[model samples]
Target: MEQDWTAVGDALRARLDELGMTMTDLATKSGVSLTTVRELVHVLNTRRRQPRTLASLSAALGWPGEHLGSVLRGRPTSEPSGFGSLASVHSELQDLRQRVEALERAVRRTD
Candidate 1:
């Protein structure tokens, strides 16, 4: 099923408001680029986002990344019972991956 990008944008905007966060803040906290965050929340762009991008954003928002990813991908967002711990582990792993990638980029810049 085709995902509703506008709805996704609206949901993101609502979450941002609830969190008292600006787009720039979300970008910085999520480790996502400002341009990507703007595009995601601006409602005019229909471009699909990468799974890792959604995962990073969800993790920053203190949400389960897989649930957010499922919603974005138009899949059912339900998880089986006892999956919460796994989701938490997944989010932590994603965070670690992001840190590693950032470090790798910084090291590359020094090369």
Candidate 2:
């Protein structure tokens, strides 16, 4: 079955919103370019087929990279291994740390 890119983008956007993040924030966190992040968020046709890009985004989003890649490639992903929430918590913590660091940087700059 063909993968629905629109659905993929919608899901990703929803996840970002749930995490209180923007596409630029996701790009910075995932080490993906802003353009690529924008394209992915908007479901625009772009050359975002690189495995590393997908892997980076998945890792940043706290999703299984392999499963995300499979879905992006229009392949079947296996059932969850029951660690979804744990991973999400971990990701949230990481995001918080990053946010703290950014705030610290801003404070130092003002000093």
Query: Whose TM-score is greatest here?
Result: 2
Q: Ten-residue segment with the worst summed lDDT in candidate 1?
A: 82-91
lDDT of 1 by residue, 1-111 (tens): 677777668767876776656888789988999988898888667776778988887776656676566766677766567565564565467668998999999999999
How many residue pairs clash in each candidate at the backbone level? Answer: 0, 0
TM-score for all predictions? 0.63, 0.74
Q: Which parts of model 2 are misplaced by more than 4 Å?
A: 1-3, 46-48, 79-82, 102-111
